[model samples]
Target: MFKDRFEAGERLAERLEKMGPFEKPIVLALPRGGVPVAYRVAKRLHAPLDVIIVRKLGAPFNEEFAIGALVEGEPERIVLNEEAVYRLGVGKEYLDRVVAKEREELHRRQKMYRGEENPIEHLSGRTVILIDDGIATGYTMKAALAAIREQHPAQIVVAVPVAPPDTLSEMERLADEVVVLETPEPFWAVGAHYERFDQTSDEEVIDLLKKGKERTEE
Candidate 1:
């Protein structure tokens, strides 16, 4: 288990350096847990950092268990975790309501943090690095990757500190290149590898994102 998120991110960056130069790499993190990792990456690579906003759709009663995710956009999408949703007895109507609720929250987050500014237009023929803490089901990461592919980056690299063997393999198939520092066999959960798995707030995510943007503009 890592002492904290920062340590995990540091280790991840070290592994990435061996891959190749990160010159002008756009480090994109899946907020809010991914922000801490990306912050370290941006620092180590001396590259611009940015956060891709995504909200997890939780079960009706237990809000922490993500049944899916809602990505912000026009005609916003609700990517459901079929396994979780079925386990939670989330039907189509229930799922639709959940999607709408999460979409509303997504709108609230963008308005509160990013204002009306659209994400940077993806410059084609450029490398893009996507960072997250860890992966299990990999649904959230899948959603993020799909969204990024829409932007048409020259390359997409997915990096993480730890992941299940299957989950890491899935990322390898989805991303142009996958760099997972550790793929612990018989994985249980992301929290198992984290010494301090505290919830990251919206404010912290925003602050880190602002840091990334300012660094890029410098």
Candidate 2:
């Protein structure tokens, strides 16, 4: 098991270096848990770091059970679990309401994390390395991939510390490459694999982003 996110990030960065010689790479993390992990990778690679804000769309009664995911954009990108919706008998009205609510939260997070800074506008022809703490159901990451695809990036690489094998398989179909440090059998929650799984605060995220920006400048 990984000691913490920073250690996990170090190990992950080591693995990524072995792959070697990426073309005009840029690191995009899934905040807020991803910022710290991505920061380590960005520092190691001397790459620019940014966040791709994606939120899970929870079920009507069970907020922990994700039915879909939404990613921030001019017109936000969404990916739904059709089987889950059909099984749960979810209606369009409910889905619409949730989308609106989640979009508002996404905007709030964008402002809090980025302030007046603009998002990276030029992703075309660059290799995008997408990072996160770990993957659970993988819906949110899928939404992130969908949003990134629209930008016409040269390659999309999804990297994380740990995830279920099945989830990694799904990611492989969407991304050009998938780099994972661990895929434990009988997988529990992402936190179960980490010794220190504290919630990442908004202020921590802001500070990390500031540091990441400075890294690129230096």
Candidate 3:
């Protein structure tokens, strides 16, 4: 178990550095939980940090169980777990509502945190390291990978502090490289791996992004 997001990030940075000489690398973090962790990685890697906003589309009955994810991209992106949607018998109406709600939040977050940075277009021909605190269902990560892939990045790396074994297996195929600190079997939840897992607020995320931008400039 990790002490906190900072500790986990520091450790993750160590692992990332060993995979050194990352060419024209840029770090894209999945906020708000990912900001702090990705902040550390960006600082250590000496790379510019940006946010990749994604929202999980949960099942109709149980919102915790993700059926798909909505990712904000140039044309926007949606990745669905066909099995989950078919099994749950989700309809177009429900999916449309969820997508609309998530898109609104994604746009709001982009404006509030990014302030017109326009980092997505720069992904082409650059190595992109996508970081998150951890993975549960992996729907969000999958969506993020798909969206980033569309931008034609030189390579895609998925880095996380902890994730289940099965999720890591799936990511191996999606990402050019995968860095995970822990893959605890019978994983309970992402928060369970951290001793001090607290909710990261929008204010915190914005502050970190600003700091990351400054660090990159220096």
Candidate 4:
């Protein structure tokens, strides 16, 4: 188990470095929880670090149960769990409402984390290593992949500290390469694998992004 997000990032970075010589690499993190982890990897790779904001689309009554994921863009991208929506008998109106709410939160995050800077626009031919604290249901990462694909990246590498075996397999199919440090059996929540799994604050994200930009300039 990782002592904290920083330790997890260090271990993950080590494994990725061994894979070696990524071409025109850029690290894009799913922010809030992902920034700290991605910062270490970006520092090690000497790659530009940026956040790709993606939000979970929760079920009508159960917010923790994700029915889909939404990512912002010219025309926002969404990935839904069709089976769940069908089984739950969710209607278009409800879906639209939930998406609107989540979209608001996504914009809030983008503004808080990035301020005046524009979203990174030069991903067309670069290798994108996507990082997060860990994977649970895999929907969020799936949506992230779909959004990144729109940018026509040379490669999308999903690197995380831990994930369920099944989810890891699914990621392998979607990303060009998958780098995971652990796939624990009977997997529990992502925080369960870490000793200090505190919630990452918005201020922390802003500071990390500032540091990342400075490093790139250096």
- Candidate number with greatest TM-score: 3
lDDT over C-alpha atoms for residue 169 of model 1:
66
Higher-scoring candidate on lDDT, 1 or 4: 4
Model 3: worst 10 consecutive residues (lDDT sum)? 113-122
lDDT of each residue in 1-218, candidate 2, tens digit only: 99989998999899888886788999999998988899999889888899999999999999889999999886778899999999999999999999999999998998998865545457888889999999999999999998888889999999999999889779999999999999998998999999999999999998898999987887
Model 4 global lDDT (CA atoms, 0 to 1):
0.91
Task: Give the distance in Å from residue 136's predicted Cα in candidate 2 to where it truly belongs.
Answer: 0.7
lDDT of each: 0.79, 0.91, 0.92, 0.91
Greater-lDDT candidate between 1 and 2: 2
Q: CA RMSD for every model?
A: 2.2, 1.1, 0.9, 1.1
The segments of candidate 4 whose C-alpha lies over 4 angstroms from its true place after superposition are 116-120
Residue 95 displacement in candidate 4 (angstroms): 0.8
The candidate 1 region of ten consecutive residues with least summed lDDT is 117-126
**TM-scores of all models?**
0.88, 0.97, 0.97, 0.97
Q: Choose the strongest candidate by lDDT.
A: 3
Question: How much is 46 displaced in model 3, in angstroms?
Answer: 0.7
Error of 1 at 59 (Å): 3.9
Q: For model 2, what is the C-alpha lDDT against the true structure?
A: 0.91
